[model samples]
Target: MSPSLTLENIWVAGERAPRLGPLSLTLPAGQRILLAGPNGAGKSTLLAVLSGDLEGSGGTLTWPPSSAWAQRRAVLTQRNTLDHPFTAEEVVCLAGVSGATARAVLEELGAGAWAQTPYTRLSGGLARLVHLARVLAHLDQLDPTAAWGFFDEPLAHLDWRYAGAALRALSRRAAAGYGVVVAAHELNLAVPWAEHVVLLCAGRLEAEGAVGAVLTPDRLAEHWGISGHVDRRDEGAVLILEGFTEAG
Candidate 1:
């Protein structure tokens, strides 16, 4: 059976105020959830909590109890902090998966030649792809029914081509029954593949639901301080922001 992640009334307390939460959500394995909001909307904070990097006060977080989460859960942070001298392939294998698995994931993600590159010598975009490969390989090593992956600003440094490739890889992972949660600044890019959307404004959840329900122009204006429309394009529907609104 697929595992599920459940959060009840979760909130992160800052020194003087709440950094995030009072948010409740349940994500089952095999689902795709997108976290969307402007800067400082607590999208990163929520991802930290979900990834077990930060503890939230006043709420419950639960997942499968039998396995070590380090093996079942994977995370790709926005920044690539590895300045070590290891090769990119070594970095990926550090996720506890076999070296072969790591190599395959890197190749699949269009970073095939990156395997032998020194991690510290790679450009930001290439480094990000290497880390992306690590997380995917990590999750791929687990039972798909119990896998969970979280990505924060995954497309930050990626070029358009690699970003699109990353989306395809993520889609394949979710299709294979692994739960995936991604934080995206570009909501339009995520909307095409996201099964559900969670909107956070000023550390609060402004809206949460399936893509069509949560990604409306009205909600964008209210939560993101923008007047926009979901424009239907030849490829798919895209969120187009016409202008800024003072009424957020």
Candidate 2:
């Protein structure tokens, strides 16, 4: 089995309250993990900690040594900014990938036509795709067996077709032994692609386990304050949300 990333009592402090943690979890290589929760659930904070962008107030995140870890992981945050006038392909090449490879990554995401387009000129969705391509391009140069990808709300600006394409690309990475972790709220879309699910509620670990085990209707109600059921189909299971739960 591939090695795993372990978090022990990880936490981050906030001005008024604990932003996240005291949460422990294991992220195994070659698995697709979905970090699901409502807004302000500390999903982005947790990803930042994993990506080494933010330090937790307490707890330890254990992975490979710093050197190897640096080379083996790629992160795509919810928001990206590039003030400089760089083309789409140039943005991807910033990840140390070859021009040809960068173009290929853009093409894979159906952004090939935008390769020479200025990043600042593209619409919100197009820019998001470009950033995602850059992240994936970085991972392409790593040892797949040792690689890890962390994404926060990657599906935000993508339409269904592109969203599916992006998920499929990430799934391919997992198949090649890259540990893929995505923080997202698109439960119906994300759940099918993930092998495991980690549900957070108000900065705490609400649940963590296999998708089938963690994403039940009752749990969704309790954690998401929603009314829903999991429809098990031959293809895969999907969350069917009916409405919000009435407040007590």
Candidate 3:
């Protein structure tokens, strides 16, 4: 069966060099994937590829033929710019989700009350939430059943409420068999929710698989420059990264 996302012979490049490879991978419907990596590992670049924000340097990145989410794939980046300062409501409206749907999405993100508030005047956290709501509204408008969600540091500057709402929505999408992929530095928020984990280091795939299976102590220490233990506790694993240094 064809997956929702396919990266065939993928190669990405940065200012310094090209990340050359004929990499092949697939992310199926109903799968929530965590793109994990140390700094400069190209996590953001990969997310860009999936969302069609940037063209890949080499190889082919294909979307599912049946559930083509070219427009449904919602991506939330850390840096969101508005050419003209808009109100919270205005931002949501741009995504083609106005009226009750927009109101509800903003309410979930705890920004409903700020409907008329100038988006430029909001705090960083609040602004991020508004942007998130906008993305959700877009997905709801385009094709909910065929939507794919991609977030690159969407949690950046987001408060607890927005974070919770964002993750909850992603989970909801996953349950509905949408391909949800997140590239984030915040491990705790992602680890529990992700069905699969892909670890990248220096532009290479260090590991990829189930969350627990891919995040090992050796890999963490080697790639992240931190020592940690992966302990299976109940249903999840805890990683004590760089804790030894703190004690010392």
Say which prediction, candidate 2 or candidate 3, comes out ahead on lDDT: 2
Model 1, residue 43: distance off in Å is 1.4
lDDT of 1 by residue, 1-248 (tens): 25778989999998777999888887766777788888999999998888878888879888634667686778998776678988999999998877788888888888988899899999988899999988888877777877788999877788888888899899888888888889988776788768778888889988887776787888888777898877655675677779999998
**Whose TM-score is higher: candidate 1's or candidate 2's?**
2
Q: Which stretches of model 3 miss by more than 4 angstroms?
A: 1-3, 19-22, 64-70, 241-248
Candidates in order have lDDT scores of 0.83, 0.87, 0.74
Per-residue accuracy of model 3 over 16-80 as CA lDDT, tens digit each: 67653445777776777888887778787777777777677788777633445456577777687
| Prediction 2 global C-alpha lDDT | 0.87
Candidate 1 residue 224 Cα shift, in angstroms, is 3.3
| Residue pairs whose backbone atoms clash in candidate 3 | 9-22
Q: Which candidate is the best by lDDT?
A: 2
Candidate 1: give the clashing pairs: none
Candidate 2 local lDDT, 101-128, one digit each (tens): 9999988888899999999999899899
Question: What's the C-alpha lDDT at position 174 in model 2?
Answer: 85
> Which sections of candidate 1 miss by over 4 Å?
64-66, 232-236, 244-248
